[model samples]
Every structure is written in C-alpha cells, then in structure tokens.
Target: MVNGVLSPKETIWGLFSATFYTNVRANLYLTGSSSCLFLKSDHDDTYLADKEGTDYRYEKWFKNYSAIEASGMRCVKILDTYELTYSTRPDARVKGINMLRLPELYYIITEYYLSLENQDEAVKYFDKVLQSRGLTGYADRQGATLTLEKVIQERRKELICEGQYFFTQKRYNQSIYEPKSGKLYPASNDIYVFPLPENETEYRY
Candidate 1:
C-alpha cells in the first residue's frame, strides 16, 4: 500500500498473495526494507546516500548490476506470481492486490507531464520513482535527456506480461506488428475492446 507524501519515518508496504488449489502464499516486500528513505530534490544527496549500507541503503546496491537484477526479480515475483493467481475475491483481493501503487502513480504522472512537453516536471517525478526504488541507468538510457518514447519503453520493460500492458496497449490503440512475418494487426476496431456482458445488460441484480 502507498502512503501519501511519505515522511522520513514512514514506510510503504506491498502485499502479494497467490492462491493455489490447496495452498496460498502471501508475500510482503516493503520498499526500502528496514530503511527509511527521505525523498529529496537533489539527486546526489538523498537519504540513500546519507545512510549508505545503513538505514536507507542496502549493501547489495554496491554490486555493479544489482539494481537491475533486483528490479527484474521484484517485477517477476510480484506481478507474475500474485497478479496471475486467484485475486478475484471482493475484500480479500481488494486488500491483497493494488495495481496502482505509488511508483506506478508516479510513472503515470510522469507520462502526463511528458505528454504536455513539460520535461522538467516529468524528469523530476520519474527520477523520484527511480530513486525511491534505487534503480539507476534507466534515467540515462539514451543520453542525459529524457524522452516520452524512453519513458514508454522503460514502463513497458518494467510492466511486461503484467495486467497493465494490455490496457496501455488499448489506450494507445497500439498495432500488433509481427516483425518476423512483417504483418501489422490493427487494434483500432471493436476487436481490442470487449463487448459488455449480456447478463449485466439483460438483468439488474
């Protein structure tokens, strides 16, 4: 769950639950682990740097490619294991699953600013997310400058195979182009959007 305007001592906890035929597992991965990250505007001097290998920093961050690897693992573990499983209950699933967490909200906000050509604000928010997650190299993938395409591409990479990608695809009305076969399947028609269920229209419960 996301806490609004995280304080220096506050925390954001993520709950992931997967149910099987005879088994269920609920995992909790709190952002920053035991550390309390204070979000700051200056990129270089944040709580992470201040508490390196201590409250706000993890020793694993010292590895050359640990951030990327850890992000990949978290993405797979949370989205794949939990989201793809039985998360269909009303209150149970509602408390268990949150598709739009803080980082996601930040990403959406960044996307909005990027659409408005507000590069400064977009970069600020996007960097906030990256810094919060202790992820590097993403902000400077192409160069010093950030672009809408880069943001889209990074988001796609982060959320691939999750439930969000399909909706994003629909929002952009993205074409399903087959590179190997050189075929483009358009998604502008009714094929992409599902029709309303007959039960809902036919009767009111």
Candidate 2:
C-alpha cells in the first residue's frame, strides 16, 4: 500500500484517462484517494531548485513527489498515455467521461452472492475482477474470506476518478469520506438528495 492507499499496477487503471484541462474555465472538486495523487505545485522550481538559501524549501516541496509516487497515481501528461495524433483536431483526445465497464458486472455478481450468504461464490466472482486487473495476489492474501467492506474498498480503488464512487456510496447508504476534514459524514437524505432545478420546479403543475 502507498500512503495507506492501495497502489497496485492494475490493468483497470488504463481503461480510462482522467485529466485536468487547464484551458477549461470551470470548477472541479477532487475528493478521496484520487485527490492525493496530484502534485502540490506545477512550477519546475518546486522540484529542481538547489540554491543555498532556498534548498530547504525545495527539499520540502520535493517530498510531495514521494507521496504522489507512493499513491501510484499515473502521470498521464508526462507519460503521454494518450496520444494526440492531430495538432489541430479537437477530437484527437482521450474522452474522460465515465461509462459502464465489464468489471461492474463482476462486482454486481459478487454482491449478489454476498447477499445470499454464499462467501465462496462471492469470492469466486470478486477474484475475477482482481485477476483481470493483475491483482490476483491481493485475492490470494485474503484466502477464502470475502466481506462487503473488502468489496467496497476494491470498488473504490478500481473506480477511482471514474465518476461512479459517489453513486456507489449513495446506493449503499455509506458514509462519505471528506479528505480535507479527514472525516466521514454519515449517510443521510440531506446529503444524498438533490433539490429539483428552479426551472423544472417553476414549470411543474
């Protein structure tokens, strides 16, 4: 584990390319383990400075890279994980939108077996997900036991930055983990429910 988080080189990580577009004028909030993956600064000075007086400051800033590396966060921009074939073509970019993946079906089957109190079947299905993602060792370490908590954690790791975690929490009525506060807010209607848009409400009979 990296920084108390799992950082396996799972095949699932490559299924989508999540990125931060600096050109876009919009607000984005990143929560949970995914937030821990970002570099603290964008400036080269934060990493390369070795001046006599400022060396200490640079050293402190450099430690952030250790944290990022430990978290196993992919540096997509630097690595060029997604290639841009045409300089002028707007469509030659990786789509960041979330879509249903085959792994979700495995997780759903695993949950179904768990609900039926069939641990063996649950583990069997759950292992399929881990195996596909080069995480069979994780399953082996757990042996024959499989719990909902284990399933939930695997989901969080496998689905990080995929835009499905919040809905997963809501479906399970699980507490939301707030990274800034380092606290979990209990599940409640106030937190889960969304008010109808003003336009929709005004037009309704």
Assess every candidate by TM-score: 0.46, 0.53
CA lDDT of each candidate?
0.45, 0.49
Give me candidate 2's TM-score against the actual structure.
0.53
Model 1 lDDT tens row, 100-184: 4565677788889988988778888887655554555334544466677666655554443234666667777887643224566
Model 1 gets an lDDT of 0.45
- Candidate 2 C-alpha lDDT tens digits along 1-205: 1111112332233233344332110112221343433432333432232111222222221222233223322322222222222234134334333255666778899999999998778878887766654454234653446778777766765555445778889998988766445666999998999877799878667
Task: Give Cα distance to truth, residue 140, candidate 1, Å.
Answer: 7.1
Model 2 segments more than 4 A misplaced: 1-80, 83-96, 137-143, 180-183, 196-205
Summed backbone clashes in each candidate are 0, 0
Question: Candidate 2 at residue 135, lDDT?
Answer: 50
Candidate 2, which ten residues in sequence have the lowest lDDT sum? 22-31
By lDDT, the best candidate is 2
